[model samples]
Target: MDISINYTRGQDDPKSGPVKVGWVVSDVEAPVIYDPPRRVNSRDARREHGKSASRCPAVLGLESRYFEIACPFDINIGFDRDKDGRPHLRNLAGTSGPIRASTLGKRLSITNEAEWRYPDRPIIQLKLPYIFLADEPTYITQLDAYLHYRKTPLPGTIFGGRFPINLWPRPLMWAFEWHDVSKPITLRRGDPLFYCQFEFDNPERSVQLIEASMTPELKSYLEHISSAVNYVNQTFSLFDAAKRVRPQTLITPARS
Candidate 1:
């Protein structure tokens, strides 16, 4: 989709004229390197693969607050949809744009994914805004996971076939096991996703949230977040740390 917008420097005013903006994305820049794939058969392959994939651009800097809106035209400052209309929000597919709406905000949409192989994928119009914490803590989690795998790689597992998917599927089984380590949490299909605004004055403070949809590509980011969560959980086991290791009484020490 051809995305055209009129952006202002500080705040948007529809009555105002055109706004100037510039965007930077992967396709336009050289690919970033974080981790690399390892041989699948190695004892440490599992951890290695995890680390490698986590390093992929699709994985890094995965956290950000995106907003969504309906209209792509002039953003209405004070106007809001009727309570009955069920207005929503989301982000442009590859690059981060503010909230996009169905009938308002920056007019944007996604065309065929293949189209932007060179320049980079186009943006998907969003209807709401949301907050994603892609900060130092998350980055450290990824680094620790990568180091662990580099030190001790393990065999990786893969499953292939077709199965029925429900709102909630097997609590056990490979899928659940795999996800349990790094389960992906998502907003329901109909739920409105939003962009998060942070206050520099009070970094701890939360900002307003706009509504939108969760695109598939954005889902990739959620998956990365899942892996980050898993790495952190596995690397830092407070429960395990609290307990001291005790040798078994049955095993006698053999000393000269």
Candidate 2:
């Protein structure tokens, strides 16, 4: 099943072709360390170490993919201290070098091409190369932004929330909020700040939850599991015990 994503390029969009947007799995390189190290000599620790060494296929299974939205240009977001003593957040971008609020009205003709104002909050806005338009029966929600996983520290925090998308006539713009209004937040060009996840939402589909008693096969399996001294050893050693099931022959089907 293929879902199409249509978009319109902004007039000041520097890129020549359509924006490259696709599915991406969570960055597994971003390690999740457990608090209070597991006991080195414990049975649980040994099991965990074995799983970790094997690359834990069950844990690495992909249930969902994040949509990466990159920043088009270098933008400096901060309050205009030169203008007034009062704090006011603003976004400025330049054509050549690093963009700042002081250099807004100086060199570049600041056009509203690669940016748009939110209907509710005029102060908070987003900059992008193009506007997306999708008529499919799909829903998109904001996932954790990529800034969280970046090694470099951000000057300011990114603000985002969940929003459903359908066959809306207007284009979809990335939402942003500057946590530090007094200080400047510079997001370099091609930096991925917006992360989202998409799911098919069929209105016609009905879902219901139900519970049932275990079958005889399931009961027998549970009895065997209860009798086992080590669960992992019993489960994973099946191929070696019977010589029938091969790990190399096991295949998991691709999800849409």
Cα RMSDs, all models: 26.8, 24.5
lDDT of 1 by residue, 1-256 (tens): 9696533333353223221111111121111321111211223333446457544544333322222211112221211124774222232221332323533333223323354333332322222221222111111010111222223221222122121111101111111011121222222222212211222222322222212223343333333333343356442342233112211111111232
Over the stretch 1-256, how does candidate 2's per-residue lDDT look in tens digits? 7796444445575332322222211112211210111111112323446556334544322211444555545666555534544334555444445545454333212223224243222234553322222223345555446423555455444455543222211122355444444455666655665665554533222211111223343233333433333455444344243222212211122243
Per-candidate count of clashing residue pairs (backbone under 3 Å): 59, 0
Model 1 spans with C-alpha error above 4 angstroms: 1-197, 201-206, 233-256
Scored by CA lDDT, what does every candidate get? 0.23, 0.37
TM-scores of all candidate predictions against the true structure: 0.16, 0.40
Q: Which residue pairs show collisions in model 2?
A: none
- Lowest lDDT 10-residue stretch of candidate 2: 33-42
Candidate 1: C-alpha RMSD to true structure equals 26.8
Q: What count of clashes does model 1 give?
A: 59
